[model samples]
Target: MSQWQQPGDRRTRGRVLRWNLAGWILFGLLPQAVAVLDASPARRYWLLGLLVLIALCHTVVVNRPDNPLLRHGTYLHLLALVLGSTAYLMDGGAAFYVVSLPQFWLFTRAPRDAITLSGAAAALTVFGGTLHQGWSPQFLTGNVISTVVACVAGAGLGLWVHHFVVRSNERQEQLTAALALTQKELAAAYQQQGAAQERERLAREIHDTLAQGFASIVVLAEAARAAAVNDPVRCAEQLTSIEQTARENLAEARVLVGSAPESGVAAGSLAITLRRTLDRFAQDTGLTVTAELPDVDLDQRTRVALLRCTQESLANVRKHSGASTVGVVLTELAGGVELEITDDGCGFVVEDSRGYGLDGMRRRLAELDGELSVISSLGDGTRVLASLPTHSQDRA
Candidate 1:
């Protein structure tokens, strides 16, 4: 799965850099205009320095959002403004302008510090201009206008910058929320898929174990009834046989519900664990489960499901298959698992009976993307075959 990340991080960084780029572009333009108009080398040199300084501000704002740089950058901008204004005054220019770097107060991380530092900057500029301009009437007039204009622009522009950044921050937050919801939805989908697979496995267990058992019970009861009408002594013997058959079915049902007979096993696949279960099963009923050698890696959950299927098959054979031998064949393939249960017993027509045991097996196989087939006759042996797809197997 792809790892999760904050969606807003990229948007915030890109948007902030773009905004500062526009500011630096305007800063660059104004100095080049000063260098072009009514030029002297001393003033041109001052404008060239302003151009370089503004370019540096772009780099600083683009790379850093910390308070100190914002403070220092703001101070540099104000000092550059004062130098530009002084250059214009010396050339007897009619008007002077500062780019008003205090607009940064609203967008930067440390706005209050930007504001405090900007105020100090404006004070130093006004103080220096007043003392150096020699207290003349023209100096007094320029001082008043400069103070009023700087205060008005800083107050109004600071509020506007704050409002714009707040909007950007809100957009960032929304992006983050959307990403979180997407991740949660993906997690829920995986959980549902796991649940569906587990349900299918349980259904198969019911078919292989419980369905087959019920079928035997039906056959045993029918046999006893038919014999009872002809011979009373034989009827008593059949009843005794049916009792054992019913007891085996009850055991199969218990194991189907996960109450397997406590045969101690450290752990492994369903096939491996079932060998141990079948050993105990053989001890209880004197029926053997035989398998040819094969290798497969089965997860624990699959081991239990397969064991239940084996348990149910063995129970049915012990109760109803009037045979001296029982055989179990397990095969492993490159991409799947297969199990075959065979018996040389009084087989019955599979097509004639829609037993619960068969139905359960069919459902379980469906879950595993597998299939079950039964081949048998009234006189010959019975063969039960089931195959499961590898991809459908749950590793859990």
Candidate 2:
């Protein structure tokens, strides 16, 4: 098969064969058909046999258009030339048979070979035609001119068809390559998106389950130690509560890690949840932590954002800040909510990129169209502020 013969080339190959065959019928067969009818019975039968031979040979070659003629297939072109020359000698109408030699050569040979072979075929055709008619000044001159014109016309047509085919093949290859590249890119993007979603899921799970559970354990252990000398019953209860909280945390962690994360926080009880979170933080840290959050209704996402921001801020204070006092304030506005956490710690310079806790807090608030800001300086303090928009309520 030819290199240009792709899986979808069957239709294209068929069209080329049909067009070339049509040209041969009009230019070669029709003329011979007319002349054969005027010849004697023996001559007519001979001419008809030659016509049938040409058609059969051409049919066999055209049937396998994708099979390159150059691959030990010069026989097809030689047969065409021979049959064409014989028909031309019998009658002038079969000139197209000789004319089609260049078209066949174009497919079978390189440019130089095709040109050389086409010239030879033209010479043979002229000689055959002249000899069949007997040498005469008018006939020889006419044969020479007509044969030259046919050869030149056929070569030009064949070259044009070859160029067009080459260009079409190149374009098809380019389109196929581009489509493959696009598919690869889409697969990569899908993989990246899946990875990002997985990471986010893990972060939220750890923050809600393991980290909160650890904080409670620390507080319970501290309380048990303090009550050890004074109240045996209280210490025992504290240990029991610690054990229960630990089991619950383990179960929650298993659920989160083993399956898809829960859909989202519930809308109601946000204020209560926040207050409980703050109470736990105060008990855990033993620092003078103050809060002023109202009982006004807020969406689940907004509540989660504010709660996370508080958790992250207090965590940073415990880990990094040497502060004794912290203040958390939540204010409900006409169209939004504001949260602020202030600390009188040995503050450091705010770097270009905020610390991990602050960055996470910022990202969480940003998802709800909220803004996060931090103000801090050496030896002074740090204040983290967040604000989120809220739709106005309809008063009954």
Candidate 3:
């Protein structure tokens, strides 16, 4: 959309018009004031009245600077033309008012409008000068030539100025609109970043605390059942440990649901959490899993991004890859970190299918200025690779 014009340009134009009117009062009317002293007493009074009336006409319209009445139509120019021509015929010196005629019509009016009105005024000036000074061939020839030249040149210059102002204002408006749109987009992006960060924080907390706690409970129960008849005392100890784990998990779940600081596996290093995730995946899916993870400290956002990518990749393999084995490898690069998940499975064509799971993983990584790539083919295998920058983390 085109931007709106600024008030500063309008005010600048208004100031120029005011100065033009001031010039007419000081230079234009003073000449007529001097000419009136040379007239007969009876004609002098009428000439003075006409001059005052003409000045009043200019004053009335120019005082209402920036008014749409004069901008959208030619009423103000027509008034100037009539009053100026009448004053010129009454007092030859009052012809100075003729200069304002072209200026008013050309400043904002259309080119054809300024040209037509200026031409009429030029004709009237020559006619009035002839009748006032008495007709002569030399006078008529000189007046016509000079009047047309002055009026045409003045009107042409005024039209050019008007065109320049219109173009400059239009460009300024467009720039202003584009700047506003950019600011809005930036604000929306910041908001989205804030929401995504909150989501990742919660997800990391759940994976570290509740999900890990549940996995331990399942393993303990399985151990307890195996020893129930053979070793009753050992099974009793296992039950007690399960009860304690469940109670701790319940408290962690409460903290997760409420507006409280998260308490979970996040307190330790990321490698510990990944180890637990690897173990749980192997225990649940019965898929032989191997991992080569780095021991490094990462900012909160990067840690969350990496953990989520791992969780999503393994989940996909367990549910869809139909793979018997999976491998997870994480390493640090020159300025960033990379994780790769590979599985021998019944993979599908990347172009044919996509679900929210994959899209969500990409989105989560993107929020951290990271990327996720999945390569797969039918009867082949699937590999998910995620890369995240370590230095510039998004706090929002």
Candidate 3: 10-residue stretch with minimal lDDT: 1-10
Candidate 1 residue pairs in clash (backbone atoms < 3 Å) = 204-364, 207-360, 207-361, 209-312, 211-357, 270-303
Q: Mind sharing the TM-score for model 2?
A: 0.64
Q: Is candidate 1 or candidate 3 better by TM-score?
A: 3
On TM-score, the stronger of 1 and 2 is 2
lDDT of 3 by residue, 1-396 (tens): 001123346676567667877887777666766766787886677666766876675566666745444554454455445444544555332246355554545344466666776666666666666666656676656655666667777777867766776788788779999999999999999999999988876775566557756876887789899989999987887788788779878988888889556444374467888888788667655679999987866776677677767776776786588899999998889888898999999998987875656776787788878898989999999989999887644332
After TM-score superposition, what is the CA distance of residue 361 in candidate 2 from its true location, in Å? Answer: 2.1
lDDT-superior candidate, 1 or 3: 3
User: TM-score of every model?
Assistant: 0.45, 0.64, 0.53
Q: For candidate 2, what is the lDDT?
A: 0.70
Candidate 2 on 47-131: residue-level lDDT in tens? 7777777666676667865444435556445654664466354744226546466355535634455666677667666666666
Off by over 4 Å in 1: 1-63, 69-87, 90-172, 185-310, 319-339, 343-370, 376-382, 388-396
Best by TM-score: 2
What is the lDDT, from 0 to 100, of the residue 18 in candidate 2?
74
lDDT of every model, 2 decimals? 0.59, 0.70, 0.69
Tell me how many clashing residue pairs each candidate has. Answer: 6, 0, 0
